[model samples]
Target: MRESQPRESGAQAILEKYDRESQFRLNLGKWGLIVTFLGVYLTVFHLYTGYFGVLPSQKQGAIHLGTALGLIFLLFPAKKGMQKHQKTVPWYDIILAFLAMYISYHKVIFLDSILQSRITGYHPFDMILSIVGILLVLEATRRTVGLPIVIVAGITILYTIFGKYIPTQLLSHPGFSIDRIATNLWYQESGVFGTPIQISSKFIFLFLFFGVMLVHTRIGAFFNDLAFSLTGRYTGGTAKAAVSASALQGMVSGSSVGNTVASGSFTIPMMKKAGFKPEFAAATEASASTGGQIMPPLMGAAAFIMMEYLGVDFSTIMLAALVPAMLYFTGIFIGTHFEAKKRGIVGLPKEALPNFKKLMLRNGYMLLPLIVIVGTIMIGFTPQRAAIIGIVSAYLISLIRKESRLSLKQTIYVLEEGARVALPVIAAVATAGIIAGVVSITGLGAKFATGIIALSGGILPFALMLTMVACIILGMGLPTTANYVVTATVAAPALINTFGLEPIAVHMFVFYFGIVADITPPVCLAAYAGAGIAKANPFRTGLNAVKLAIAAFIIPYIFIYDPILLLVDVTIPHFVLAVVTAFLGMLAVSSAMIGFFVSNSRIWERVLLMLGGLLMIHPEVYSNVAGFLLMAIVWLLQRNRKNGEVSQSAAV
Candidate 1:
């Protein structure tokens, strides 16, 4: 009924303008200022640490607390409104911000010389600072992410405090003293400024900065232009373009829902104009956008976190991620192609499509930064150093074209923008650190693994199912990085302990599921964002996204079962076999979902095709042979039906 109300284009224009202005102000001031300072601060600290490593845990805690608090204040709004002169800062906000900074900055005051000389010890001032910092972090987390993560964090923290009173199996040693807890959380390396914070400060920020520099160099736009040139004249051109653009966007943006909203705004309308149903259009965009987080080069912040958590080289993780990432995009692209065929959608006119040579000539330089980044990292520079080099290269490359020039003001703007984007991620990592701290202190990770193993009867599939469910549930509320952190700590070890899966494979499995949650139902934010643009039912769009991304859900299991897909322990022949089988499996799954191969498939055909896909996914001689046979049957039947239909139509 509400949808029946007449809309005013002028009013909509005013609202859009208002929102843009408000967003700009928010980005430029609070979010921008804090992130810029944090970037500079962390860069300086890292440089100093690299030259002269400090062992002071309290000092480390202080730095973490300060950065976290700064992010909280800048990234989150005290309240939402449009009044230009309205005072957005509340009294409590000021109190908390100051407290967080004080606690972190004055960590030395809290420790005795012995504690300071050995492990960080409790000082009175440190106690006060820790309390304030913790409170601020909780409040800031509540404001930025949502009540769910804060509630989860609060419950976990509370459980830590009250473990002594719990049942035997769930309990821990009569837990830490309040002062000790504060000191550990606020001053120690195990707490606020631990691995998560270290990863965030050292790796995540540099990548975020790299993304900013890439954007300044017009690399993202070049990607869009390249996609347009490549796909703008194919059948269902807009949707194809959306897929290409989103893949490129995903490589840099690292936020699925954000990427969906960004590229979807353009591609969705174009799709609708090209005769796609609104819901299908939205689903296409959402599913494609969500796949971006799993894209190679950069996967949300999870890739960096994975490198830290696994203690593997960045290049190793990137190399391992390649096949799975390709499989993800391949599935989406195949699914979209089938859907286009089913609907008989047409592409853009030839006149509107960009000339390939001309487009490449203009934009080829835009790709140099990414090339340099991968090359430098492979040549053995630390990810941090490589990222800095990439950032510099991006800036330098921007100067080649007048349109992509990065002025001094724009450089500051990019820094500010990069910082703004990095804030929520910073908070998520810091909050996730609390979960990691709890697991480390209580050995709860091992306990949880034991429980999962017992429940799963040590069966690999059962354990994987349990892990996937946990990931989806957690990912419904948390960002990809936090989701990966929580699941990797809890479920990854369970698979390793129970199923004997490698640590890297187990972590990758959890990470994949966590990122897939963006398109999963109930709380599929990327799908919902797409629906908003398409004016389609959000639930329907989400369901469609799930269907479209079914391969992503299944492929992780395949990789876990047969690590060759992830390039683990493989001969050349085996690797080739795995690639061929996986490709066929994806094609089968896509065709089944779309119900169109050469023509419309019957119910039996669909079921058989799906079975073939499943068989193809599992690595075995018999299953692969059976899958190939079943696939051939479906193709022959579809071809026969299509030829018959054409003959009949010709007669008519």
Candidate 2:
């Protein structure tokens, strides 16, 4: 219960540190009213677009960016907790807000003429505002998403301007002029209004808004109760429940830290109270929550963007994500089971478990919207349409269930919350648009890919390793949308365009690594959030999280080499083989990491499990046999050890 509450200053501080949306807001009557109006205005704009139609991509993205800027300046202070006026907007932020709106309005009204003149080139007003607009995005992003992405975006812009001098042939470009760069970035759909922001504006925001609505219906409570009922009575039950509950919650929420904080509040405490160590308890929640972004249907907004990029449908992605998602959670489940076995931990008391049948009967309606989203996506509907219908279904079902019903005030609050929550993503995607634009204009993507491939001596495995390290480093301090867009823009091209990996496979490969950065060391925000709740060390929680999530690191490569794992180019036998090998590989790796099997594993068993996992995971028939044989050997060793203990116990 104490973990569930943010009363501890440490948790509050950690929340603010990792989650930009969790910062202190000045709760003034007048200020709240203005913020509410701004928030509702954004929600209405998106809802109207989602239902009727969206504006031109350029116009839509500009308006979206402008509204987000105004909200960020008002809601998030330039410095944390440094509001100059308690109940009033600071003069500078107000100026920036109006400037953002002014640029957006001009872009919409004069955009046609500006585009026509771009060849002949730039009116004085166009150039000035373009400069201002670019700066505004960087500053606003810094105020919202943090300095890492802004720094990355700035370096990209500077590279666009100065790339001709890079001397290295592979990395060099003839370079783009300031006016040319500014025009493309500000006006064209290829730049600040590119696919990334377009997806965020048109698709991702609807999902985020729907997510807030989903949360309001108390679906999270249903998930938590369901997890407890299913797993709370077994060994390591609470930790297993945490894994299930966090993964379920993460699937829709798409934010690793946000999901950790939300469900970790409930699951982390239960885990610690059930005799799990604080850091491991926190790590379990952190890793499982990170996996949610890769969960199908929503996949935390990246799936929709991938659909747009790959020119495929959401159904294809949902199908592809199925095996990987299952394996990811299964690995965590195995880790928790072994942890429980090693520590001799027992489950929560029977009284603590919810009555499964009654609970489902009473609350199952809350889950229908998820089904609606999945069904519609599979049954020939666009994802946007699917999301819209799903949201409406949720609303209708809520009216039928009084406990889940949204009062008029509650509805308004959710709307405001939805808009506020989406600001960080909106800013991140728009800035990513700048980077994407530069990549496009300079042909930097192809060149960068060439350099990386050449550096790896054209070896695919080596290239993948290089790409993974790049993703992890760049992914630090960046949100998922921005991280995915950057990697998809630059790194994905190397695999697909140059080296000829399957497009979807390469994209997914980049996405998985990018997402794992949230749980990797030094800048692991999700693990930091878990540490906050468990009162554990941040780096220690991150280390444990990486250990538990080893499957995420290894599975992408499995699907990449096999493709059968993703159900691509596979016979039924091959599909089944991939599934069996992948799961067994997961089992081996997890048991190796946890240092337990039939009982506590020996050093040899751990090494055997590690090698078996690597070999089995590679998808080669011979390697699978060798891997299986090695695992069987380890299994027999463990069995013999078990018999020796049993005989000794009997003799005693």
lDDT of 1 at 551: 82
lDDT tens digits, residues 93-122, model 2?
778878887887788888789778867877
Worst 10 residues of 2 by lDDT: 1-10
Report the C-alpha lDDT of model 1 over 1-652, residue by residue, as the tens digit: 0112233453333223312211212333343444556645654554444335543644654574476576466435554433233334444555666666766666545446525633544557657766667767766666566566777777777777887877766445566666666656655567666777777766786787788778777676778878988988887788888888888888887877777776787789888888888888889888888888777787678888899888889898888888988888888788878888899987888788888899888778788888998998899988877887787788888888788887776665666566556666777777887777777777778888888888789777787898899999998888788888888877788788777888888888999889888888888878877888888898898888887788889888888878887778989999998889988988998889888887888999999999999899788879999998899999999898889999999999
Model 1 ranges off by over 4 Å: 1-65, 79-88, 108-121, 168-173
* lDDT of candidates 1 onward, in order: 0.75, 0.86
lDDT value for model 2: 0.86
Q: By TM-score, who's the top model here?
A: 2
After TM-score superposition, what is the CA distance of residue 52 in candidate 1 from its true location, in Å?
10
Q: How far out, in Å, is residue 385 in model 2?
A: 1.3
Residue pairs clashing in model 1 are 62-104, 110-123
TM value for model 2: 0.96
